[model samples]
Target: MILRRFFSSSFRLVSSSSSSSSSKLGGGCHRDGFRAVSSMPEPCQSSPLSDDESCDFDWDSLGFGLMPTDYMYIMKCSKDGKFERGQMSRYGNIELSPSAGVLNYGQGLFEGLKAYRKRDGGFRLFRPDQNALRMMTGAERMCMPSPSIEQFVDAVKQITIANRRWVPPLGKGSLYIRPLLIGTGPVLGLAPAPEYTFLIYASPVRNYFKEGSAPLNLYVENEFVRASRGGTGGVKTISNYAPVLKAITRAKSRGFSDVLYLDSVNKRDLEEVSSCNIFLVKGNVISTPATNGTILPGVTRKSIIEIARDRGYEVEERAINMEELFDAHEVFCTGTAVGVAPVGSITCMDRRIEYQTGADTTCQELYSTLVGIQTGTIEDKMGWTVEIS
Candidate 1:
């Protein structure tokens, strides 16, 4: 698994964004988190059936598969105004134009987060506000409507609560939430969509890294760049990922797990994983690539930063070249979906750099601390967790 920075920069957005003037939820939860959106489509009105009667699944032992539940949350906007309240409904297909902005020009943004089940039987959203705010930033970069933090958070809570049975038991897994904002308006003229849809769906996933806790081998292409200076490396647009599939496929056929991309401009600085944030633990100091607009700002990355600061370990976010990485004692990656992945070695053009995967490394410490908080095994000092039984 890797921590691909969430918000890579974009050459698309050239405008400035002002902060939303609201603070309803605690710690900027209700405000400054999402963009203002308009009202939603006609809500599907129906009472949730009992758990036994509603659709059921083997929540446990749920490998990474899409077990579609019975409901989803949806909100829409146009070129005129902000977003509106969305409604929950039976999960199904969505309407889109053949020439929609997303279909032709690829104007889209997405966020990935999960809701965990506590030991006491309540559900919790693990720092969803961060995910919400990140999605808004991505939307802004894509020239799309930004849903308010309240709308995003409420939609997730409502949709997940509507299908609480999908949330796995303690130590089982989580209800993975995927909130998407896309342009559905018919436009082939290369302009922003007059219509947009903000939709949320949940999937029960045991772990994103199918090969968990094991060492991974990464190939450094040093050829394909995930994002570059002044590029959309800082946004969560879908177009960024489509380009990496060929490289990853080529690596996998050779028995590699993922491809680590270098800075596009210099080919010396480290950017990030295809889906996670990369970190290096060299003896005592912790090193991650500086956010130069080409890497996603992962939620896990932020948590690691706060945790490292509290523990007083030397943490530096600066330029990390490919040369400096071979000298590191250990390396790991973090993201919302990928969790924390410890990299054992990096292969590049017949050369490889192997590192230790011992328990003594700070990367290990950070992983333990993060997993502890997410699984309710450790106290959350930063108030990053949100309960939703």
Candidate 2:
């Protein structure tokens, strides 16, 4: 009822393509059963940056918020069950019915990836293929048709290039790419919608948490459960996120960076933080909660597991008990937005456990290595970085 009322009042119909000039890229054309549109007003001929607009933004102060860019990629599917080719449209809002599946039934999924400005003036995307694959898996579960891996990658690259000026300087920040798929068609009953919309947008972001790469203080949430077995926890569904906002807000109000949720059934094993995957280190062994049904298999978490193993540190994926976490030498979290952030201390129940978070810590080393590879300063021997042409 809340989402229904909000959509009914706020949603606006998208304008026609003929209203503005079109600039097509990456083999996306109107002949592919689709039409491209630029939502810019008259006199703004193209979507890319002009010579005068190149140095206008203050890249240093860009926080992790929605600073709308020049363009977005959008595609749609009809009730007949055929997905049309997508096109680049100027960034703006779109209309939707009050009974849209996403509003009424929570039928939607999304992905997050970043594009970095290389030292040589080129752009690169880190492990986008993983995001593509994960999105396909999420779409299958959410009962929506998803773009193919090639289509997914191409759309991301095209949108990133269209908004290239917003990519920011090398160390300032990265352009965060968000790919969203939602059931848009109106539905009366609790079922899948007849139509869907797939949209990709880019926003310049520095860090998810206000504490950039600094150590984080977390509250172990034994009261609220993040997910349960056979739930939508393993996928990047939009429905899985809103429920955690209450717990995260409550934790932050008390001066904690985020909430570390425990398993729902036992309340002893660690699940994950609100947005990032958690990792614990003891001596030379690095252990994290296994991605059993309830945990999200984070792309950053996967990359770190390989990176740590290649660096000769033993890594294990299993259920991490709270008692073991309190005794660990170091704690950290990994994600696309968080990168690699060390945990300073965790307040579980009434006891507070603190860990060493100095410059010489293992998490600091991993964070540096991961960020260096992402920003193109370190040699990428793992073949994870993809250049955006």
Top lDDT hit: 2
Error of 1 at 252 (Å): 0.7
- lDDT by residue for model 2 over 1-389, one digit each (tens)? 00111112222222222212111111211112223344444222342354224435787787888888777878776433544556666676666778888889999999999999998887899999999899888887877777667667777877776677788889999999999987777789987776677789888899788987678999999888999989999999998899999999999999999999998898999999999999999999999999987899999999999999998999999988899977899999999988998999999887899998979889988988998899889999999999864
**All candidates' TM-scores?**
0.85, 0.87
Candidate 1's TM-score reads: 0.85
* Tens-digit lDDT string for candidate 1 (59-114): 55677678775467766563345564455555667656688778899888888988
Name the weakest run of 10 consecutive residues (lDDT summed) in model 2: 1-10
Q: Give the TM-score of candidate 2.
A: 0.87
- Candidate 1, residue 162: Cα displacement in angstroms equals 1.5
Alpha-carbon RMSD to native, per candidate? 9.5, 8.3
CA lDDT of every candidate:
0.73, 0.80
lDDT of 1 at 377: 86
Runs with alpha carbons beyond 4 Å of true place in candidate 1 = 1-60
